[model samples]
Target: MTEAGDDTWLARNRATLARLQFAPQARSVGRVEHVADGIALVSGLPEVRLNELLRFETGQLGFALTLDVEAIGVVLLDQSESICAGARVSGTGEVVRTPVGQGLLGRVVDPLGRPLDRDEALGETVFMPVERAAPAIIERDPVSEPLATGILLIDALFAIGRGQRELIIGDRATGKTSIAVDTIVNQKDSDVICVYVAIGQRATAVQRVIDAVRRHGAPERCVFVVAPAAAPAGLQWIAPFAGMTIAEYFRDQGRHALLVIDDLTRHAATHRELALLTREPPGREAYPGDIFYLHARLLERAAKLSGELGGGSVTALPIAETDAGNLSAYIPTNLISITDGQIVLDAGLFAANQRPAVDVGLSVSRVGGKAQTAALRHASGRLRLDYSQFQELEMFTRFGGITDARISAQIVRGQRIRALIRQARFAPLPESVEVALLGALADGLFDALPPACIATARERLLAGAISGDEAAAVRARLDGIVQDLTREAGHRPSDGASAP
Candidate 1:
């Protein structure tokens, strides 16, 4: 029960109970009660929205209010009782929750956190609250640990740490959803629970995602929330928050949680629509003046709480699709500034057949240092510099025969490195495999293999045929041999004696 404030908004209306329900029902409007300046009340109503209050289904008889009073309290009408003259209704601003434990997996849900499939009923469960304030500074733990996505290239560069908020911004068809889903599937052994909230997406798209997640055998560890296109606009506004509430329950219980908001752009648009409907002042792009506050509060809830509070943390990967691939757009820029870092997906590179066409030069991880382990940082230290130099000289060499043996050798090695970074299908790589693969590439192991053999060589590494220490030795020797071959291509005289 919510206590009344000094000034409450209430409405008084005499109407019949449209349906039998608890206080909180999604998109349902109750009848108006007594109207005060800010507080209104019908007999026996809660202070919160009817959809929000219906979570508690009391068998007690009462009236119902349908629409929000734009301020406070609701009005209920009881036909049996003659109290219809005027009565006070109250609302408790809360959401229903599902209990933690076994069997929550393999479930599809709506924004209200209720099962969409009516065939299976959710038994008595603990109620999780949805509207929560941002976490306090004292509750936060600095993000220092890495959350390996098992995608070799991403793990090697631009590492995403647990409890970090990362924005995956890209144009349409850039494989953003695939990356998020793949991350969820790959986290099976990491002991990290995944919550995927789909807002304002097509039912077909949502169905495909569910099928893929189940196919990966991650249903037990994954929680999926969907707000279909046909659902009330308000559901889309509240979907991400509802998903966060569920993730927070696990986090508070000292379990790692991963929440992916498929596309915040749609969520923001819906919010703008609601605000405009509510007659709020529109600012940039017709968004409310509090747009920053709206998003910031939502995202700030994602944090690594202190062990003293609850060591469990939430790592959020919020995907945003840019309109026309513009990063300068209002929402994109705002998100970029708020997040710990962003993975910018390049449409141009994607068009060039580069799977996960991440623009190495443009895509960056600002908080990557926090996530990078000492060994990882040391081993891949020179990668950035080397790639930059190689790319600078690449165009000139493309003209054919304008390069010396040394320059040509560098190009060959760099090409091998780029190919090594190409992503494979969603498969988890053991730390040892990643270390060996990256170590060998840094030392130029793939230089001798034909470009066609890149896939085979990577497979061999994954198979553990070569250890990390041996990778450097073998790679150096292979690079030396490739340089020798390039020299032989020009028929240059050997400066040193041939090996026995």
Candidate 2:
């Protein structure tokens, strides 16, 4: 009986084994011929594609940047110190991808989707390629809704719209980052998700931004992608792209998102370094000829989807640094041309005690009044024209005493306008409060009150309850509030002064 059972078991196992098939597979593996400066020259992976991920023997990762008949240029995403010449490199048959989804919210990460804030798992999520094509013209809808910055100047003048790419150009320390942070803080009660990518910034600086948003804004709705100055050039270069991919996930889900690339000047420099390292011919400013295309492709991804796609949008505010207010510089100009509009900050005005010194004449929104709220569009109709005229007249009056009563009164009104727009950092006005203040100024509500009184009135108005639905009601309530503040300050409003 035992012999019969053993024979039956062996026959069954042999039958199953005889039904199996075996096959041989081949992989394209290359060897690093040269390695240095976060780049490597590999020589045997003839089948490798451009931008495909590469795995090295040292457990480091890189991407094929330039493919040649003889060698492939690779950019290392991890530290290159461990990778040496003759190291084995294998093609992963995949491009660089990052984790994307709600799992990324409230977490700080690198360009590779690795968590940087804490040792928590990202949970189950989908991966998306960092580089993606922009939406076609037919797939995109017009940017009709406003993305409020809560800044009186930006809201009243250069109103930014959802799905728009607005460039923030300024000299160092002129409050470029501050403006972006304020915008994020202002979205505390909004449904829009925020993605802040800090490229080549200091550790402390990146920390400050995270702290500010956590303290003043809704941290639960934000994602911070940090590639500090000390990070590898490859990481910094990919930081913004990874962030855009993350934001795109939300937009695809029919939700709105905002992306802030803290500054791209460093990214351009990083590109130049890599270009020179890889022996690419240098163009203007020693950058590669494809620099413009590089950014254009990245920024063009920000768009408002058509209604059929769920009416979602991605608004991008990319910051660019200028040398001594030089907007004509290569990087700044490139960004200015790519964005829907540019918000130029003046260091001179900044030094003059005007915080967030936005150059109104130079800062223009191509979307213009179309993206503005009905109340703001109505209240600020003639404000810019009068303010520009006042600026010109005030400059002339500084040269000599003005005898004309009209010119003198114009200067007074211009001064009031300047004082009204002066805003402090971290204090963003709501849309309703902004409309109310602008309306009050348009109605000659602050002509006689001094600058100090105007500040006091603004603080009071900010504290008061205001609604954005009814502009006229808010303006009426603002009138009473301003009158009370002026009376408390022992000052009276002008009886017949015309609005600026």
Candidate 3:
């Protein structure tokens, strides 16, 4: 067509679209030709766009995932058992969206933004699209400030930053969700809002998580987006994006938000199922090759916006499950490359009674010292390396070889440090408290304590430091602890070698 003719045709089409958009009840109806595995192929919904929702004659909802020459593939968002062939379907001309605003806080909602909690009637509905383009690189700022997960070991070593995308990858039951949950619990006093997206999880398990957040007194600052096991695969696939969109709303409003995708392994599996149903070409492990892009786009939404805009951020803590701790598997490896870093958990450490089971050697934070408080930064200077050395030496000494005094003392210090990091669930320590304990350790204060009694001594001393005023007794005890450390470090041991 000639340029003028093309422009004229486009103008006419734009006018027609405008009219259709403003017209009331301008719905295009279609008929379901086939229904299987929660997906329906409709033959007459020609006006439907990709990802557009449709309403059936039976009032069920779906979205157009594929549009072929003769049929449109619709993924049902609800139960499909009642839906069958020859059912009428009408295009709603709207994409899926979720409720987003201050009102959504403390509410447990499904992917479609329906209130799952008794107290939430979805007041002040400000809905936003579940899929949004990530902020551009220029709109982003450096992630320097700490998110303060309140776990001493993580805060001291593998610090997470606001607007950073960090993956938590490990085998099942290896404390991945626990870390995310603990981080949410730790945000009780902060201005940060939290969105917990539970995809493909059991209803009882989701309830337990909700209860834990409630018990931590942080429910008011958190939103729950759950697509339980009973939900359709489509809902499970959209749940994380819905949660991300909610967090984006808060970020755009000049508030910080944290999003926890409980685990993307199941999310990926759901997407794989949908892709298979839609007849897409499956790649490795039967997952579509675009799976990497799926996660990358989602994680890219986590950015520290520049000061010119609202200095808000959406920090993503995406969890992924590894089969038998095989992180080299396709999905886990894909996530590892997409995120800034990962917190690796070890089942061996879990069996050894480590609460978090964080494998220090494997876990790393690219943000590093910049994401840590100065006090924590100073206190944690040599903690990781020292701990690694201690582990090596202890393992070496197990062969019943020579026992150097330096190695023995180092092992003792490592034992004390390990005990120091053992924390109970829901007990997220404050930054100051962590700094004090770690600083005391850095100052050689805890090495003199008995290894088995390290936890008790730390609690007593920390309690004295936190609640007990600068009393003479507290000061004297602290001083005595420091003196003992000095004595332990300086004492000449019989047949002693150089200190490690």
Candidate 4:
């Protein structure tokens, strides 16, 4: 019996050995023609698709960006110092993709889907191509839901609709990134997923943003995709695309998303550098002729999907830095045209210590009126008009004292509204609180109060605590007060009587 069992085991082992002798073969390999400046010209990868992933014989990774007749120009995703001419390369037969899931939130990664925050790899998650086509017209629904920034002026006047592409254009150090950060902070506890892409930023600058995000308790809902300034141009160029791809993954899962590209101006410059290196013809600003399409394609992917398509959305807030407050610059102008609208941060206003510095005259939401809630719509009506008129008269009143009491009253009302718009950093107001305060302002709640004290009052109004079983009831009572005041303000007629 023992001899027979031994013979049977040997026969089974021999059968298993026979099966392993005839399995499928590995992928075909290619050779690199040249390597320089984070780009590799590789021959023998004619089968490689555009934007496909490539692997070097030495374990380096690159992306196939340009497909030429003789060779493929690949963008190295990692350090390229070790790669050399005539090095053997192999095709992964897949395009550049990044991980997407709840796991990605609270972690930091680069454009190539490599984790940077932890020593070990992230858990398994779905991977999506960095480049994907925008939804068709039939697949999209109109953007009607309001995406509140918790900033009074922006919500009251230039509302950012869900699924809208809003451009934040301003000069350097004018607090463009601050606006983005506050918006991200406001998403806390909300279902909206926030992805912040930092391209060509200093490592320390990116770290500061990371710290701020954590301190605000939004790391669970936020993902930071960074390609620091020290990284190669190719890495910087693909960072936003990777971030967007991750955002789209969440959108497809029927979740809303907000994506912030800290600045696309750097992205454009990096693309230009790659273009010139690849011998492409340069257009205006020494950028590639497709500079416009470069962003157009990326941004067009943002949309509100129809209900039949799971009713998800991805809103884009792409920031662009201008020189000397010039909106006519090539990059800013191009972005302005691509986005649904722009929020211009006036340097003059910023210099005056106007926090958030939004110039109402220049900041407009094309999706306007509809994007606002009923409470906001009622309170903000005629706000921009009154503020603009006040500014016009204030300039002339500088030459002489106000002779008319009417002009004096107008100046006083305008000052109050301006003070109300000034919000402190990291303190994003809740929707209920914002509505309450705006309604209060509309009802003359701050008329006699000093403008300097307005900020303090607004903070207390929002920060007051009410907890337990009575919290909901108390909030409803507060909301009722706000609604009544807003209603009263809407119907209240202006006093025509003038005082001497």
Using TM-score as the measure, the top candidate is 2
Q: Which candidate tops lDDT?
A: 2
On lDDT, the stronger of 1 and 2 is: 2
Candidate 1 lDDT score at position 346: 82
Task: Assess candidate 1 and give its TM-score to the true structure.
Answer: 0.76
Per-candidate TM equals 0.76, 0.95, 0.89, 0.90
Q: In model 2, where do residues sit more than 4 Å from their true spots?
A: 1-20, 466-469, 496-500
Weakest ten-residue segment in model 1 by summed lDDT: 55-64
Candidate 2's residue-wise lDDT over 1-500, tens digit each? 99999999999999999998978989888899999989999999989998999999989998988888889989999999988898999999999999998889899999988999999989667999999999999999999999999899898889999999999999999999999999999998889899999999999999999999998999899999999998888898899999999999999989999999988999999999988888899989898999999999999999999999999999999999999888888888888889999999999999898878999889989997889989889888788888899989978878888998887777877888888899997888878778878877887888767767788778866776654546666667777776777677788745635543
Least well predicted 10-residue stretch by lDDT in candidate 2:
491-500
**1-500 in candidate 4: lDDT tens per residue?**
99999999999999999888677876677888888988888888678998788889889888887889898889888889889898899998788888888778788998877889987777657888888999999999999999998787888889998899999998988889999998998888688999999999989989999999899848988889999999977789889999999999988888899999988999998998888877778989898889999899999999999999998999999999999988898998999999999998988989999999988888888998788888778867777897898889889999999979889988988887888888888888766666666665665655655666667666555656332223234344544443444345553322322221
**What's the lDDT of the predicted structure labeled candidate 2?**
0.89
All candidates in order of lDDT, best leading = 2, 3, 4, 1
C-alpha displacement of 399 in model 1, angstroms?
A: 6.1
Candidate with more favorable, higher TM-score: 1 or 2: 2
Q: How would you order the candidates by TM-score, starting with the best? A: 2, 4, 3, 1
Error of 1 at 51 (Å): 10
- Which ranges in model 4 have alpha carbons more than 4 Å from their true place? 1-10, 13-28, 465-500
Give candidate 1 misplaced runs (Cα > 4 Å): 1-103, 395-401, 404-406, 463-500
Off by over 4 Å in 3: 1-27, 462-500
What RMSD value applies to candidate 4? 4.7
